[model samples]
Target chain A: MTHRVAVRPSGVELEVLDGEDVFTAAGRLGYRWPTVCGGKGTCRTCFVQVEEGAENCSPVGPLEREGIEALRRPVDGLTRLACRLRVEGPVTVTKRGVRRRVQE
Target chain B: MMDETSEPATARCPGPSVQDYLDQDSRPVPPALRYERNDYLGSEDIDTARFTSREWAEREMRQVWRRVWQFACLESEIPEVGDHEVYEIGDDSLIVVRTAPDEIRAYVNVCLHRGRKLRTGGGNVSEFRCSFHGFTWNLDGTMQTPPCAWDFPHVTPEKFALPEAQVATWRGFVFINMDPYAESFDSYRGTFDDYYIWPLENRYKSLHIAKVLPCNWKVAQDAFIESFHVIATHPQMLTWLADANSQYDVMADQPNWNRMINIQGAPSPHVADSVTEEDVLETFYDSRSFYSAAQGRDLVMQEGDELPAIPPGGTARQVLAARMREQLAATSQQDFSQTPDTELLDAINYLLFPNFNPWGGAKSNIIYRFRPNGLDPDSCTAEIIFMSSPKQPGETPPPAKIRWVPEDTLFADIPELGVLGPVFDQDCENLPYVQQGLKAMRKPGITLANYQESRIRHFNQTLDQWMSR
Candidate 1:
């Protein structure tokens, strides 16, 4: 089963499969997401503000929490690490200020 | 600002912090982890002719360049079968290719038919087809097709197989030797296993930068072999690097190999009298914090922040290293948890033969290779490769394409170089000046310090030995 993930502002919708992370889902649909840590949840560069449907994403893992704390990036309860957020149902999110640098 | 006797100051720690954490089973470093060294090198006048004279360079191309085992490319660079890299030295270019799942082959990159250069750069190809004449050879250099078969009645496929060179691998580095009867690579590279047995194969090349330097290859290579120049050339490092006190150990039994173990998190012995515990703390905190920030980690310190307190019973170096290990464990899935403080903080730099300098470590481990720009006495190709341990088993990072920076380009333009850019920029600035000085100086030779520049002396002796052959 696939759930619709609507990226706000861009209004791009991606059909995220079960157990697929939001970052991977977005990447499949030609949406660029920063993956500095190669999606290990170590680098907080892959964060996205979940505008709605937090229930669709997986509960924040230990690594995700540690990343958020370590990076000192304040995230509201709705903010989800795109690399860590496994899509469960329909969701809406906006990409945070993160883009892959050409050199990196 | 108060008088010395009035207040009780926080006592700085001594020795390594992680030493206390080690139990009986894992405290002692095994024999495999150690490298042998001999510090017996006599001071000798290194002839300036080797650097400035084209005649010497010509002789070196035939004798030294062909004879010595030189780094061709990384095995990771051509991971797929049929992928090849054209490694050129002097007038010779060898196509180092992966022919099978496990086997790698190297052949002179010249077409047998018309002697046209088969390939210029690196790429994957099922067979090497000459652009000039369409003469083709299999990945293993067996002649596959001669365009218009009737044109070459005298040439048979069996007899026209491309000539091959001796190829060997250490860790992930592919080395090639052109000499028909070169010594067994094991015997030739006796120092490599003993010194860098640190699972270097587990690391993947993440960055590569090459630039043409206006200096002899030997001069560019020699600049990096010793830390003594850090005092004069990189004076800012005087606050951290133990330049004078740094141990320069040479394996006199081994040819053209030496290791310089520079003590980091300490001031240079040149200014030992002025060094204080606070200076050590500041250096450790600043360098570690800066390194963390460069790696996409949040700043461990802020502007005007107080230096981290040295842990009890630990020196500043150990404290910083221990914290770094913790940070690494927390940030990355790669388990460096087993690596001891001694190996983690060890700032040992090894110079292997003609030109390969690699420091021991996972992160911040930089490898340098210098080569003559195809027999140019006044110019050399300086390559810098940055590597880190693979995050997963059998994981290979993408082969970083060599970014050749123009001489006029600012070092600041390449932010991926991290802190190394400024340090290398300084060396690049001095290389041309040194080259010009070598030509203009009335002195027939260069004099090296007896103890400090022993690596340079050892290297010269090895070069002389190779050149004699």
Candidate 2:
């Protein structure tokens, strides 16, 4: 079953499939997310604060944990790499610089 | 500011770091990694004319190329007395020959009698006999016969010897200097020997691919010297390469040489958020096949071969490096059990100034040489030498003949380059346009990433410094 990811501020909602990360779903849904490594957990720029449905997000894996630890600032329970987070249910996230492809 | 007894502290380099991956290596890493970093050159766009101006290229040929110790040929190429290879650089032709079992000498290819080139090709020769006038010189470059014994009364052995270039051998690689009074090769090389750990003497030139590129020599060279181009030029490598996190070192001690350590077998931060361990491993399978073919070594994997999956917590680097160690330990006579992942898996690229690139690694040790393609200024010849480990320890195999492909033929069309060819093609395609774009762009210069492209700036700075003299 596909879950809904609501990117805050931009209000861009994405239908994320099982085993798919949040960043891929955003691109698949015609949205551009801020990134240098582009979905690689290395840059950690595509990070989000979970505002709602925390339990629905996938558990942080080793890769995501390493990336979070490398962040300059301290992380709380809501902070997660958008590229590594997968949702099982409807979730809300805050991300800056998210945009939809302009339709011609 | 208050730590008086400790080493001087420098500013921290931000962003994803190669040191993080080095700390992740399961095996002991190279001690060379402990050195301090150099200051940034500057945040500036270098002049684009270096790639397009004919006058700039001419100045480089006279100023830079004339004075540097250029890598000519390997000692194994001329192990026997009288074995010779013709090395052609910008407007200069040299005959590198083994004068004795232990001595190698480089002579100006032109015969003293006339301007005709004495040797057309490399092969075993009793002497260099100019087919034009039959003015012959022995293997030692001493004048032997003048064809007509009584015709010339002014010829003497002392004045008649072939004009020689300064030649030096370091660990089996022969380097030649066109300037007779040029500084000794040891001094010109600087502290490169300190960090370079690979001993090339035990390797043989298994494959040599020389292609004439349609851009200035430095343009072709700048495409390399950094992994910054991987995101656009070699996207296939991103799944297993750490492009942004790779280390770049520019030091005052080794002004003539600069180095970079690109961590292979790991996902580039560019794709790190989305790529998984399986995806990284998958790409390696494809590249590993081609890398083996390029080296003419037995394929580490065959068609339908099952891959050992990356373990639950293990990295692609750890898994692949372990596999390489197993392959080397089995096939090679030397002990590879203790070789670190950095040596076996990292792309340790080093540039010996002007135009020679000798990589440091236990495997995938390739060499690149770039020179102006016959004074065109707009064209260059780039050669890649795949250095392979000998079948038996301490044994040297005959070097492969340099294969020159047509300028228009894509590197992908070359059977030996395999998948690496397309990556090269991407680099080649951009060069001509870059040469033309540099001429057409409204901007006077192009900006560079202060940290990533520091190598390019270091080289250009060095070139300008040399040219001003």
Candidate 3:
């Protein structure tokens, strides 16, 4: 089942398929996700908050939890790394820099 | 934890970083390995005069060079009484000598007679006899005689003895401080010892290659302090070394040193998505081939050993580190089974203030010492020494002789350097132009990356602290 991710403010929607994280899906759906380490989840620039349906996202893995605690991000406990985020249903998230890729 | 909530300086965070690997490591990592703090050095352009000016060089000799502890030479370099080596910094030189079985001393290398240098280089000698005149000093720095003592009443033993510098030894390194009132070398070194798992004293110098580069000492020193240059300067390393995600740290308790830990066996963050674990292993094998050959040991890939397969869900680093641990355990006397994979495989480098770098323990046995090539501010000597573990357990290998690579000789041409040669050459290619650019640039100061090149900035801040006085 394909999960829809509605990036807030910009409202760019991504069809994240099974095993595809939002960051990878963003690439396939022709949107540019700001990232320094690509989809490795090393660079925290690609983090986002699950504004709606936090329960729909996969459980936070150890590396992602470590990243959250180490970086001390998310005033709330709802932040998930877009690169590591997997969802089963439609979810709404807030990220400032997600935008459609400009065709060359 | 870094207290990142209260610390605005460390706001730039990296995930899946060196810490993730450390968290997975079986062995407990030290605070030194886990430590993270950045004393926010404000954005400022560094004056070019710090590198290109003659007066700037003279001031460093008087202020910073005189005040800090200097790594003169290894204690093993002067193992016996009367054995000495002359170390020169800027305009000053000192004779670092082994006075007795348990004592080492450093004295002004100048002759009291007419201010001529007493020793030109390193050698084993009974006493220091001034070459220009017949003035002599005993191994302990006591005035022995003046050729015409009766004619020279001013040459008294107490007054004419060479002025001694404060001396201290840590591990196998003999360090000297010209300022008699400077802090103890122990305090100066601080908790820097917390990082070294493989004691440097247990290793012996196996290769020494000093190359004169056309750049300021700091310019040459900065090149090795960060992994930021790896993606551009050492592209081949990206296959197995994680550069951008490498940990860059400055301990608040110890500002005198900064650390960088580059995890190998992982693709660099820059090329993460494109590379596979199998590619990482193949490249890793090629990288160690030369150093393995130089040591007369093919531990990484012996004659017909097949490439170890990286199991699904496993990492190349884990596989390679396991191979190294098993090899070292069987071939040497040390217990390596519990050694952390990071210590076994990563580039765990630390730079002490001024210019002393202990790269890491275990298989990566590299140490770097950078100095101004005598009084010249624009040129500096960069020395690379491989201090390896004993091939025969308890046997300390003979100290390798220094081989100065001519300024024009590419490091790759040097046989002893093995694979490190080309890497050094690639760095050397940019330094001369960098020096020239700094001189001719319109900008008054050099700009630096806040996180990646923070070590260089921290070094400059420390240099400013020393020179401020």
Candidate 4:
């Protein structure tokens, strides 16, 4: 199973395998997502807008909740943490313009 | 409930009592009165040339940075056991490693036997053994095994442990002190707690970008301290991102830290007073109005009033600026007069002395670490990390891709430049030149103009004070 994730502004798209976290999936597709905790769900830079297939993603956890509140990001179901979210099916993601490109 | 076992006993250790360290006579040397050297250069003197020289930089490392609490890296950089990262400050090299679950250690990077560098780069290991002679040291810097323990019968592994530096962590940032007698990290950050309201511990690392430069560490640091040069040095950034000559304020009263606030549209461009309530409503309304107008969406105005006329000089930039001004104004209307409603502030840049600066705005926040290149006086390296909040739980972390824009590329084409790296490069391009110019000065001394860049003067004064003592 695979999902299609598209980054906005740059309009780059990639196919990610199912069960992969959004960050890693993005990485597999040659897209870099920002993750500070090295994918432990801590830095909160991997936010993306789920334009489609929101129900196919994993549920949020305590760590992700704490990170969102600390960063004061808008709390809506549409936005999800890429580090915490694992893909269940096909989905599309939109990256925020202001966020920095992931540093290798 | 607080986990007693997980927390270090010193975690709750009381900070130095007011009488013990802050009593008028007993206070640590004041940053203002300590160094009175006339040879120091002001902020304007910062440029690339000064960074490349190896000799002049060594003097600064000995005199200034050796006394400061330098950030090693983020704790998450070495999250798992045996994970490691090597950091070089001035001529000194130190390694930070996770030796055990929930335990991290730092040590001078040199080997115990022949004094060769222990590890080439970062990696996981149960023990770090020097490849040259197989001198083995545990992750905690304890000497574990000598190549031939029986041959050197008199030598004790326990007695030859690697030296440890004073290390501490606050909000996930690892800081180390080379001087054994240096004050505690909390004391070093004193009175600046209010400025670091971000939940840094809760925050994780998103990206880490480093660049080796040819200028002094101070030149790299001073670039972030003030916005005064944005107009001339970064014309594109100033046009789109900031208004030069904004009102500026500096918290000189604090020790080992400085807090500066810059208000938009203010004359000094360095600080600003708190925003007011009317500002927020107007900004929100204007943003909605202009965005609607540009997209040709229907204007949802109050029944009695036509959509408020777009104000004069209202470019999209002005509209965006108005929105920020309004948000800050609304936040100021709240009863918390003592603290700025960080939520609404368009931009806030915090400078941690010696060499750390963290800046945040409505968009994202970034952390910068500057270090001297291996005890060299003229060259340095800077590390930059950009971060943002996660949108929801269970969502995957953001991708770590960065679009590397070459020096010749215009700033507008680079999306991330406004957020971190490019802006830093703008500062970097000039530092090496400044370093070179400083060395060329026949007299080798430069005077600071009081009104233009007082922060630089203040920094040098503080540096001299700390180094002399």
Q: Note the DockQ of each predicted structure.
A: 0.01, 0.00, 0.00, 0.02
Q: Pick the candidate with the highest lDDT.
A: 3
Off by over 4 Å in 2: A1-104, B1-15, B149-151, B287-300
Q: Identify the runs in model 1 with alpha carbons over 4 angstroms from their true place.
A: A1-104, B1-36, B287-306, B311-314, B392-394
TM-scores of the models, in the given order? 0.74, 0.76, 0.77, 0.59
Please give, for residues A16-81, the per-residue lDDT of candidate 3 as tens digits: 898889999999988899875567654456889888988788888655664575458753448888
**Tens digit of lDDT per residue, candidate 4, span B161-232?**
888778888877788887888889888887666555665554445555566666767777777777667776
Question: What is the per-residue lDDT of model 2 for residues B1-469, given as tens digits with 9 covering 90 to 100?
Answer: 1235433334334445778877787877878864537656665678887777888877787888877798989898887888788988777899999988888999989988868988766776666767566677877889975767688778776789988899998877999998988999999888888887788877888888988887889888888988889998888889988898778898755668889988888888888889888888778777757544445332368668888788888887888888878777666666878888878777888888887798888874788888888768788988988888876787767888889888878777876665567777888888989877778998989776666787887888888888888
Stretches of candidate 3 above 4 Å error? A1-104, B1-8, B11-15, B296-299
Leading candidate by DockQ = 4
lDDT of 1 by residue, B1-469 (tens): 2234422322212332222222221235444335434455554478899998899999999999988888899999888898789999999999999999898999999988889998777877667767566677878788965667888888899998999999999888898989879997888877566666566677777778888888999899988887778878988777766676555677678775777766666566666568775687676555444433443222256578676786566566666556667666654466766666545554668888988788875455678999999888999999888776545557776867888989788554677675566777887778999999988999988987666687888888899988886
* lDDT sort, best first: 3, 2, 1, 4
Q: Which ten-residue region of model 4 chain B has the weakest summed lDDT? A: B290-299
lDDT of 2 by residue, A1-104 (tens): 89999888988889999999999888888888886556755456788889999889999865466557656444554889999899899999999899996777
Better model by DockQ: candidate 1 vs candidate 2? 1
Model 3 per-residue lDDT tens digits across residues B86-165: 98888888999999999999999998989999877787766776656647788899987577789888668888889989
Docking class of 3: incorrect
How many collisions between residues are there in candidate 1? 0
